[model samples]
Target: MITELKNIKKSFGSTDVLKGIDLTIEDGEFVAIVGPSGCGKTTLLKILAGFERPTSGELLMDDALMNRVPPEQRNISLVFQSFALWPHMKVKEQVAFPLKHHRFVSEAFKKQPDVRVEEMLSAMSMSHLADRYPHELSGGQKQRVAIARALSPAPALILMDEPLSSLDAKLRIELRYEIQKIHRQFKKAIVYVTHDQGEALAMADKIVVMNAGKIEQIGTPQEIYYYPETPFVADFVGKANLLEGTWDNDQFSPALSPNVSWHFPKVSTSFKQAGLCPLRPEQLKPTADNQHGIEVEIQNVQFQGREMIYTALANETQLTIVSDADTRIQIGERLLVGT
Candidate 1:
């Protein structure tokens, strides 16, 4: 492991921000920490960047303790949401700043700062705007410069706090590919904190879901989406419609329609104990057969280019379902919905 956070907890007065966070980042791994607002994702990122000390527990970097280490002393780089570039410095100067000032800068970089800066600018495709100031560059360019600067020092780890949150939708998508390219080229471990689940799902190798100051689940994107261990993970990550249900072995009978039983052998025990069954939006299908499904009323419909999204009600419970564009169901229409 390159970095390890063991039982990490943090609080400000009576408000506990992070409660017993334990995570490990392997070398060159892209780990995304995602959660709703005030879920301590940023706080956890700050702790990793050494901006805040943990209340208790150990932080290890390369097997050495880093709990009380200063941000400047640690071999870590941070890229913030606001694109914290120096307004006075040009692009080249911003990329060169770390090599000139960082204590952990290698001898090769220190001896040839100009060459290193050029290479970083080229890597981020910012060489064309080398002399441009922050005011002269677009938002995406400024972010690219910031990323180049972060990578210039060749830090052991990089901590990014919503780096693409300020960009437009198109620019965000473009930068996602850019970031992933550099990650592959440089092989640096990243601890990314973001509120956008789509970004986390698209870019991260591993996803950490958090809620109410605790980690809900940690797994690969497929695992987190396909097999959520908690109701919160199911609802938050995959937007799975959780149905109140009772379990009998591998079969589940939803409370709304006791006659309907679903056989799912792989559900987590926590969900079974809570008497809940999570069904994804695509899993619920509208069927003409009335005997083998739950009765629901279509409340709303949204037509995308390829698919239609539906808001439905069954026994006072609201559910979301997705279907192909060709399957049109008018609002307020009664239908039988089944898996």
Candidate 2:
């Protein structure tokens, strides 16, 4: 493990924050910590960076105990949601600030990071504006500068706390590609914290689902998306169409109207109770030729470019169907659903 945290706990007066979080991050892995607001995700990052000592746990780096090290000595870099760039400094100067402050003793040595500034700027496509001040850059450009500065220090790990939340949707998408590219080229371990599920899904190799200041589950993106271990994980990862059902021997019998009867492959054990089946919107298709598909009425048609969202009503339940733009359907038309 590149970084290991054991039985980490933090509390503020009477309220508890981060109740015993044990996380181990491997080298070159992208681990995203996500949860609702005030869930202590950022606090965990701070602990890893040695910013705040854990009220009760041990942190290890390369098998060396480091519970009381200062933030700068931990070989960790933090990138914040707000691009905390010096407004008066130019891009190159802002990026070089860390090296200058540390007096890295590389000014007189070759094969040092002084040669890395231009490369970092070029990687982020900010070389043309290297001499420009932070105030002269756009929000996206300023964020790139912040990222460049963080990577310039050659830290072993980088902590991102909602770093892309400040950009607009388009820029967020654009920078996600850039961030992934940088990760591939640099091969540095990253611990990203974000409340946005989509960002976590898009960027993380492993996701740490947190709730109430503790980890709910940790798994790969696909594992978490398809087989969520708990209701919280099911609800947090993606858009799930939850249907209450009762297990009957080898099948699931739904409780709602337009009742669904789905059969699953038999398992070693049996569970029969009121449970939820999380179906993705894409799983429920509208086809006119199936016996298992329920009959419903098309309530609305939203023409979003590239795809059309078909909303239907059945058994007093609203169902959303995602189809390509070529799907021809009118409002109030009849449709069939295959659960």
TM-score for candidate 2? 0.89
Candidate 2 positional error at 71, Å: 0.6
lDDT of 2 by residue, 208-255 (tens): 999999998898998888767666777688866666667767676666
lDDT of 1: 0.93
| Per-residue lDDT of model 1, residues 23-119, tens digit only | 9999999999999999999999988988899999899999999999999999999898999999999999999999999888999999999999999
Best candidate, TM-score-wise?
1
TM-score of each: 0.96, 0.89
